[model samples]
Target chain A: MAATKDPRPCSIADALALVGEKYSLLVLREVCLGNGRFDQLVRNIGAPRDILATRLRRLVDAGILTKRAYSERPQRFEYRPTQAGLELEPVLMTLMAWGDRHLRKDDDRPMVIEHVCGNELAPVVTCRACGDPVRHEDLAAHPQVSGWTVSGPSAA
Target chain B: MAATKDPRPCSIADALALVGEKYSLLVLREVCLGNGRFDQLVRNIGAPRDILATRLRRLVDAGILTKRAYSERPQRFEYRPTQAGLELEPVLMTLMAWGDRHLRKDDDRPMVIEHVCGNELAPVVTCRACGDPVRHEDLAAHPQVSGWTVSGPSAA
Candidate 1:
């Protein structure tokens, strides 16, 4: 990791602050898949119970999820995704796609996605303006809102 | 996180296994931003020296980055992204967008992306099948390849 003299804000850092922990997004993933109960999350996520609780509270605080009562007698709560949480579907999808492409030995994708019509699907990221598949070559990143200086290995 | 009774493959888990740690992606971010030297990465990422070294080696082993001899006098090397590393541009872009939208205070976005035409851009993830933004409602995730039971909050 390189040190930057400029203390400009970095979005990657902010996003990581939200979900970069090893098990944070996994918790959210479980919630996204509708496993909102604490016990269910504990079993599936394989994270410590306390850590799971903390991540849940953090996600709620981050406005990505909301907690609602599912049972009154036991005071059980079910976590649900807010609009912001739902927006993370793409990030999860892309992560899954990358994993499917690079990591798995067998076609044993843990979760298989499909449409009601029984059509298997893969999602792609594209440009809103051009409707073209977004690629590294097609875009350049500026560290700040302005002043586009070329950096990275490609520049070499 | 939900426990899966069925031991199917999970791409997200696989991907997370590679880069889900708190500082792993940060290291990658610094590298992606062209801060490949050890001292540069350490300063910018604020990660421990040993951890950064370990991550750089792991990234090299993962085929995401390659090490090249940059200087012979002192035996210095530069880390460069391979094809796989470059493919992560979209992921970084999306992360930046999320941060800018939800995390930043004064719009100090770490990375600003622009098209060749100088049009500021936000990458959108969509499905290739329908040319539509793949939202949670548009699809369903099955625990297994054969079984297609809908199990998510949106199902209700």
Candidate 2:
């Protein structure tokens, strides 16, 4: 089936639509972590050949990734992130942290991501207005009439 | 075609696979903003009717969102985020900030999101290790052979 046209109300939706498949984010994450070969992504992601090919093509089309012919002998190709793709690192990290926290068991750490500064990484969300970290209780939504009409909950 | 299997190497991939369709994130975003009704999502998202129905069903199946019959006359339904869905707010906010920064023109602000304290909002990412805001330069990936193998430029 043809992919749906991206709904652009929010950039998150646009980004997700572009890379929201089962293997897409993993492919991007692999690329972000420096994996670029088609074989490497297939191996790491453990996806079927056709599915991997489609996801890679879509990433390249979206400017999140680019492929270069590495060798003509075996028809080899390598993938790399474009600037747009690199910008997605934070999002990837945030998702990783969420998954680790919510899904993974306490004893079994899936993978460890660290900074160059020799510190174990944690994902943090900061408030733009006060420049302080935002907790769940710290943020609330202000609704416009359009927002209110659509939303079922009263503004907190 | 059958949907691709969930790529298990990363949690982000899992999350995206579950609710990563064209209108899924947008619908989730609207729900985060308190917009829940069927007509409201249709107005906000502009997605196809069948696709929207499918996406909603998938989200409900995955426990990210729940559907309730809000009205009887026209058989209206309202979508609400479960805790799982509410947990996605940060991810959505992060994507919105990225879009505003990269996609919007300098003169055209698409929309303003305000925090409960009546402050205009901007989203920020910080390092979990140092308690300092993370910049592009602060992150680095170590080449571990066991994880996804990377073959691109060191950073991108």
Candidate 3:
């Protein structure tokens, strides 16, 4: 079945719609790691072939990834992240950091280390206006409803 | 079926394994927004009741959320984010930002705006060392295999 257009313009919801599937982010991880071929993604992500294929198509349609033919006659293609896909690095990085910190008991460094600085990165989201780390306790959130920001709890 | 244990100590993969189900993140989003009650989350997220219950239990088991009795007698409880769960705000914020920038086309603001800044929050994952925004093209990623940082391409 095809995905339907969203009725509301919500960022978190939209983001989930893009990468909420079981293996979507894993597939993106493989592509980000320069493993672009279908077989390579399947091997790395451990997804069923058909599920991987469907995710690839959805990601391509979503503009997060692009497909390019690497070989002719036999028709082999490689998937590469677009500029949009590249921007999702923070999400992936933060998730990794969170997992390493909370979920796993890893003494070793986590996967995907940054080369710019030799330090293992711990991502913190800061407020752009006042330069404070955004925390749920400190901030009061207002959800937008009917073109106005309404004060209430919202996730969708 | 039970979720399989990951052999590797990769944080990102482990994190995904915890929350990669269809409605898990959505459920987390609900809790993050302070919608603690079951009916409230159900109303906001629109997941099946059974699925939402399962997601909630998984989240609690993963220590991302905690359940506390809010009402007496009948035994009603509310879910709240732990320190680890609160740390996931960055992931949720980045996903929201990504969705707004790439997925949706509404001229209005996309999601829950922090009351601290009147401006819409734009979360950027910056290097802890240099304070520059991390980008995929700028990052040279290395995968951790057998406790070694092997070089590869990364988004940030």
Candidate 4:
């Protein structure tokens, strides 16, 4: 593993960098779903014990998760998402929707997301400018920055 | 490092399992912005060379990005986002908006995103059922399965 570099001081980057790891989202999803115990996360995600521990610690360090002592006998702790972590629910839902649409083996029956409104949900993006729902073709490249201006093997 | 375990069979889990790693979103962001070469990614992100290579390969495998050979003499390759990858631009834009609102330093201003209509862009989520805009608090939770329930841990 490479040394964890200090993240590019941007919230989106920080948020993604923090919860962007393979196990982090799983851990967060479980916690959001009300599963917070070490054993519960391990059972729910089937991630390794050490990896779960490290991810939980990282989440706690980032303030996305908080750990509370659950028992003293074995010094057990349960992880819970903070408000910041709950904010990621939308992002997770979008990712879930993408996966269901493109990667699911059975395209007809993908994972279901129910809105609090008693409605089954599908991920949707809308334009803030026009209050119009944005379809794929609705978006065109803004020329202020041309593709080639930022294009190159060495510009990243 | 811990062994990679098979995540849940759900699409959400599968998607998260794929692009949920560190620098993955950053890599995707760069690709969406049209930075395609390995050296450009390295220059933009400052991620380790090996890690960048691995991520580029993963993106290509996921169909979010495609690699094209641009030069035979230097044996150079460039990455471009496929339609699937372009669909994620809204998500990335939303993430950027969230970051700009919550994460920017006092002195630094993030780049502005404007629609082709010359309107400033902001992230907005829409309700698929009624085609109405949905606010964060307006969402109501409805569980499809008996075992799956929504509850706030803080409430408990």
Candidate 5:
């Protein structure tokens, strides 16, 4: 077998390999927002038709989405998130909140989410075990891959 | 002026427009991991040299990273995250956590994080005001753009 080039395997890299294609997350955004039909996704996401179709197919194949026939006459289908895909919603929420804070002024934000708490949702990432906000400085990384360290591949 | 397309604005789309390019988030990952030198990023990220160079330049231009001169003779530089860039670490964390959960088995996971509370960090998105875990069924989205609704564009 060919020698493993990057022995430091990363799940982030793996996840991106699956959904990092252009407009993939946008498709998820549309679906999660209760617009799952092809036409709605095309209009809302504004991705080119062919590209949207491809991304949808890829997402479905990855099991992040399920396609079910919603129209009998024309066999039109709508996409729904699988359990795995629903778990990605927070990723979108945090990204949206970050963009809202950094990229746009309050009045110019294009969407607002309201949590069940009856307040405008401001998504924050927190550690599950301790309920502390996850910050770069407050965490340490351990490389689970053999021959690797947080700095880089461990010295051979 | 060219006709406006995608007039129903979205900050998520805007954010993705900036960082959603291929390998962009992975670039952020390496810098956040403190492996910001060009060669270290190239080796760790496994991106082609020219492409990685382009990505680094783009990230620098986008204000997510600052390039600082580190070596005098050869004029070597390293990348560091700016405030906006640091804010994006949570997105990376959530993505990594999702990949770990959905894509990798327990024994095969590549990295683990330890939070300041001394437990393995499991990142969860929660509502900032109420401190409850954010879930799909417990939130409502209100479109801020005029002539738009959660389902799509309202009848114009």
Candidate 6:
């Protein structure tokens, strides 16, 4: 059987299609971190100004962010996370935790998130129903597409 | 501080620097899903062959994946996740869950993950110290870099 010609219609794929562009999530990082002004994003993300503008526009169009006027004289605007964008914070946290574990020394971590629980935040993905930390081996995927399986496209 | 001339060094930024390319995470997605061969990846990810090859090489070089000879006669190789790569599964799961909640109808989700605990997996990010599901408002960011705050660079 040939592998399916199309990528599986997946929400992960969909999410990536929206936010996977270079510098896009970094833009989210800046905004979510409360640095949302254009100049601040340009400085904090190191994305070229034009590219940063484009990303901000795309995010706003996708409803992940909103722009609000923050200055009156020059009409300066700032970005803010919409609900959808705020919810992605965990994804960013997990990614950061991974990088902290594998790429940085504990003392070299660039920033730390302190959860309201009073400890430095280490994000863990858990099963909502079971409250157990998720592990790769303990999960089984069921492709909801017509002709695909967890392994690949089903034989025609 | 004039917006601090440098982007705040961040592990999230470091992680994004490594896997922030267009198809890198999707490549990881396929490998994690057990479709690790070249043809399988090509079919499953729909990335151009050459681009996919570059991504595979980069992933292997980054130690997120390993290339192992799977067939001797034709010298075929398959990719497998390293420990670091498996740790990224939660990020993917969370991204998928976000997309499912925001972008797709419940019945329209293209896949479901079944946790070993006999429930459909709904990945939730929780605080490791407190076991509470993380919320945007409940977290605080502390920028470790000098002259930076959650809002922006401090005035020098």
Predicted structure with the largest DockQ when compared to the true one: 6
- What is the per-residue lDDT of model 1 for residues B48-121, given as tens digits with 9 covering 90 to 100? 88988888888889988888878999999778777777777677777777777877677666567786556787
- For candidate 2, what is the lDDT? 0.69
Give candidate 2 regions above 4 Å deviation. Answer: A1-8, A48-51, A68-76, A134-152, B1-8, B68-77, B117-119, B135-137, B140-156
**DockQ of structure 2:** 0.37
Question: Judged by lDDT against the true structure, how good is candidate 5?
Answer: 0.85
| TM-score to native of every candidate shown | 0.88, 0.77, 0.86, 0.77, 0.92, 0.94
The TM-score of predicted model 1 comes to 0.88
| Candidates by DockQ, descending order | 6, 5, 1, 3, 4, 2
Score each candidate by Cα lDDT: 0.74, 0.69, 0.73, 0.67, 0.85, 0.87
lDDT of 1 by residue, A21-109 (tens): 76778777877888778887776777788998899899999999899998899798988888878788788888888888778666767
Q: Considering every candidate listed, which one attains the maximal lDDT?
A: 6
- Supply fnat for every model shown: 0.72, 0.48, 0.63, 0.41, 0.82, 0.89
| Runs in model 6 lying further than 4 Å from the true structure | A1-4, A152-156, B1-3, B152-156
**Model 1 CAPRI rating:** medium
Q: 1 or 5: which has the higher DockQ?
A: 5
DockQ for each model: 0.58, 0.37, 0.49, 0.38, 0.59, 0.64
Q: What clash count does candidate 2 reach?
A: 4
Candidates sorted on TM-score, descending: 6, 5, 1, 3, 4, 2
Superposed on all Cα atoms, the candidates' RMSDs to the truth, in angstroms, are: 3.6, 5.8, 5.3, 6.1, 4.0, 3.9
Cα lDDT tens digits, model 2, A1-156, are: 422333324555555667666678788788776767876677777888899999888888877889987689978888888777777778778877777666667835556667756797787777767876654345655432222333336433
Q: Output the better candidate (1/3) by DockQ.
A: 1
Per-residue lDDT over A1-156 for candidate 5, one digit per residue giving the tens place of the 0 to 100 score: 533456247888889889888889989988888788998888888889999989999999999998988789989888888889989999999999988888886567888998999999999999999998998888778887566646631211
| Tens digits of lDDT, candidate 4, A107-138 | 54434655656677765777777876554344
List candidate 1 segments past 4 Å from native: A1-8, A115-118, A145-152, B1-9, B105-108, B145-150, B154-156
The reply for model 4, stretches above 4 Å from the true place, is A1-11, A68-77, A108-110, A134-156, B1-7, B71-75, B105-107, B131-156
